[model samples]
Target: MSEVIANMSMSLDGFVADTNDGIEQVFGWYGSGDVAVPTAVEWATFRTSEASAGVLRHGLATIGALIGGRRLFDLASGWNGQHPMGVPVFIVTHQEPTDWAHPEAPFTFVTDGIESAVAKAKAAAGDKNVAVASPTVVQQCLDAGLLDAVQVDLVPVLLGQGIPFFGELAKGPVQLDGPTVVEGQGVTHLTYRVRR
Candidate 1:
């Protein structure tokens, strides 16, 4: 059996990505130094905080598979054939992109729905955890009672407007516990258990 965990790094104001502005500000803490066109590996490996790196390492180690949304897939187009997580990723999308269907790519586009995507991800994960990295997918899982835990790396910044992590919770009011707050250098990790 595998647990479904939704994780994200959000601003203090609860914004995930600053819409047209992008997520560079919200996630700036993840990386450091400016380079002339850094590779996807460099983009993924740069770390400003060792604690944040530890958290990410722990997450990647515990999770066997990842589930994301179409927009996220598009944003991470640089991953191409090699993914940073080194695990199969299930992407929820309305339609599969033709150019993205590489045989060597560790990605599966689930056109059916979030549940179907999650089912496949869980199967792939086996006894480990299945991580939902997209906010939309996380909300869908929360609504459908498919999410087991919610983890947010709370960054100390205020994005006036942007994509939010929570939207139209279909399951109504979801009670959270612990929040198991851990203070890092640049971010605070908040882990909450979704009460059924």
Candidate 2:
């Protein structure tokens, strides 16, 4: 069975990025430590604490597919055609990109809806998990009751206001259980299963 998990590094104040769409404040932990964690993409290796490295390696090994919003896709410039996770990426968008350079890449532009994207990603994942990478997609998954778990790489900072990790859920008050915690140098990894 493939479970859908929402994962992101968030600020202590609950923002994922600053008002200018900057993530330096929240993503500093990726390079703040001594342990090296390489990804599928050669340009984006992470240097984090040993604990965070373990968590990143575990996710890289287990997550089979990724679901993200079009906004994030554009922000990352389609991750140069290959995402760091080396998994298939399913982008939820109203329309496909007209001049996408990486047509041969394993990127699927899903214009129908989140449900359809999830179905395709799950089938692609086989027995592994589908990771939701965008905050908007996470919110949608929460509203649709499709998210199974939430993984928060909590960074210690107060952004005060910016792009939040969560938004107005159509289905409010989602309950979660058992935040298995792992402390890192400047961040804390927390995983909570969604209560059914």
Candidates' TM-scores?
A: 0.90, 0.98
Give the least accurate 10-residue stretch of model 2, judged by summed lDDT: 166-175
lDDT of 1 by residue, 63-109 (tens): 89989998888887726756777788888999988886476777888
Query: How far off is residue 106 in model 2, in Å?
Result: 0.7
The residue ranges of model 1 lying beyond 4 angstroms of the native Cα positions read: 32-43
Q: Where does candidate 1 clash, by residue pair?
A: none
By lDDT, the best candidate is 2
Model 1 worst lDDT window (10 residues): 33-42
- Residues 66-178 of candidate 2 have per-residue lDDT tens digits of 99999999999999899999999999999999989999999999999999999999999999999998889999999999999999999999999999999998878999998
Residue-pair clashes per candidate: 0, 0
